[model samples]
Target: MKSKSFKRYFILLYPFLMLITLVLVALISNISLNDILMAAAKPLTSPFYRLSFIKEFLIVGLLSVAMNLSLSMGEMNFSLEGIFHMAVFLSALVAIYFANFFIIIVLVPIVLYFLWQVPKKVSRGDGNKLIISSLIFNYLILGAINYLVYTFFSDENISSAVTKDFAFALDMKLGVAIAVASLVAFIIFAVKTSLVTKLKIIKDAPSILTSTGTEIKKEKRAIDLCLTLLTSVAAFLYLFLNYNRFSLQSFTGYGFDAITVTLLARGDFKKLAYPAILITYIRLLSLVMQTEFSFVSSVMYLMQGVLIFISILEARDDRNY
Candidate 1:
């Protein structure tokens, strides 16, 4: 029984183990103690970088929870990446040309409403269709957005636009408050609500719920809206915090990163914070390494792959037990 419990909670320990591995790797790479200390202290020493990281943590955390909630019901919304990016991009463009910061208040809902309709019309409550349609939509949307950015915006124009009030629409204190509240609210919705029980039934035995007159598609559409709302807010907060340093090439692949975090949490919303913190730590560390130690950018991708691999191995072990 003790061993079983250990096995069950081992994922919570995995992040620390990865941290140790990173330390060992640093040592092997001739990183001095002072360099390590400086890297650790860098974000704290720079206010802007620190605020950027805080925003990243909140953004990624919200996305992870949203993804986990959807996956719990056997659906995956890959279009979140598109929605997250496009909403902010459109808002920024409007703010740049029209000089109106509040334009995002209109743009966000419009973009989300458009995206929200795609999966609903295409999938009709089938999880597999939702996955395929969202994935394809994600690619098309991202490609089109990037093309427009590359075509119309020079680097200087992009820089000027980001430096304007558009990015800093919300003061830092208010932004932080909203981000924290959003994450907390979503967690409670996932863990404390009765809707989760219905979602579970839908996951494990959809036919059982269908026989009892449960509307599987309706349940899924509700989850879909919740997810879009979170992603939209996350994108808005991200623009407020990081848009000053944003780039046309600034996609974070966080849509997929959320998947790895969710898998590590083993479908438990209560454990979601652990994996979210773990992924955020890895991201911070990756940035530190790249900027301070001159490490290659691909190091972050490698670390992400390692995390998914470890999660897969643990998942296989669980099945055996």
Candidate 2:
């Protein structure tokens, strides 16, 4: 029974599947698999590098899990992009003045609690309304953030159109520890607890979930609110490691990789880690290939576009069949 439940959690051998796909991609490009693995293994080969990779993976994994919270509930909270940047911008403003703990305890949560309303306001109805409203509210938040930053901090050197170093930031180690903790908490909440069963109802039988008077809508918003808080906290911590301050640019365009990772994982939390690593590697490879490998970034993106188009075609065919 335990083994069966474990299999259900992990689904197929995802780690092996990722490795095989990676090796095939390497061989097709005529690159030595050893070299590719070695490059990816810099984290293991070097301790400092390992921390960087761990931090990176934890960020990706956390974002994926956060999105899964809402996506599993048949919702997509795009305001996460806004929430992330707003917290990032807000972090710099507050962290520059206060101690690290004060920033984390007071400023971070306060910003998150307010920005949490954006998703609640935007994601009113499901389907296109959800997507469009999310995008709309996301921009609205970005605009407000931009105005506040410009109006208040326009003359301040600590946080303006330029980036500046600051004191009282989370060290990479502590940031990574907190990120791991967040991911673990999310895993327990999503997987080990009964929330998964409720989420399944939302995903597979929304009508039933609604009919049961389960207050699932309230639950869904609460979960999204929690996720927004988590992602914002991590974003604030990331400011300490790098990018202490910057202009109020949109982070909405970011985390597109999370979507890819979540889709590949298919809501299997245990399957999430391997794909997160793979997508992160793909992201890094896209950067690395820009300079050395024969495949330039444009060519890589073109190939990706082609593959995505074919996948869409295949999906359409399956649906029609």
Candidate 3:
């Protein structure tokens, strides 16, 4: 019975199976017998590469969960771009002054609260309206954030847009530990808790997302706020892990990847982690393939799009709606 129950949920693992298929394709795209042998021995030869993969996955996973919460309500958030920059800058600023990780953590919720209010005011109770408003609002906020980063973070030590690292939260060991704990705890709470049912109900009936006044209450509001804060935290954590330098660019590049991870998860929070890992592999593979096999790398993203679409289709459940 236990094995049967477990097997029933095996379909949820489709993202990973797709990921395996992808890995094979990538390896074959520019195949070499020696490279195949190296790939087989990679784990034994260089275990840190595996660690690097896990670290990237956790970073992507946190941001995906943040998006998943809002997506469950049938809403799209583009504020992730601004959130990534602001969370890192503000958190790094606090770290430089106080040298306390807790301070950075505490400040995230406040920053997110302000960000969360932006959409509520701009959106006219419509999902598409919210997306447009978010794009406008986030870029507006991004301008201010870029200016601040360039002015404050870009000093004499930093000739370009990047800068030196800050301590406290910048430790790789600490970041990895936090990532593991976060992945485990988030999965447990999202799947094993009562909130799972509420999320499922919302996923099945996306209409209720905009049915304002009496149709919604603290339940949905609480989840949205939690997601907003989670997105900010994900940004904060990224800065912690890769605090080597700051990017003053309008976008930090992970916003789309985060969205891809969330969409691939397809409302099943339990399966969210796998999609995050899959995206991480695709991204990392693209980086390697870009230099060695430019043509193959160019097609990597298109391949990922096809796979994510198929995986999401498999996970789609349209019963209640």
Highest lDDT model number = 1
Q: lDDT (CA) for every model shown?
A: 0.68, 0.60, 0.62
Clash count for candidate 2 is 0
Model 1: lDDT equals 0.68
Per-residue lDDT of candidate 2, residues 87-154 (tens digit): 77777776655545565656675667666655556555534456567657767877887777677665
Model 3 poorest ten-residue lDDT run = 312-321
Model 3: CA > 4 A from native: 1-48, 169-173, 183-193, 203-215, 242-244, 248-251, 289-321
| Alpha-carbon RMSD of each model | 4.5, 6.5, 6.3
- Give the per-residue lDDT of model 1 (tens digit) for 117-196: 68647998665567678878877888877767666643564453233334346677888888778777765776675678
RMSD over all Cα atoms, model 2 = 6.5
lDDT of 3: 0.62
Residue 109's lDDT within candidate 2 is 59
Better of 2 and 3 by lDDT: 3
What is the descending TM-score order?
1, 3, 2
Give the alpha carbon lDDT tens digit for every residue of 66-138 in model 3. 7777767655665666666677677767766667768766777777767766876789665556767876787
Clash pairs (backbone) in predicted model 2: none
Name the top TM-score candidate.
1
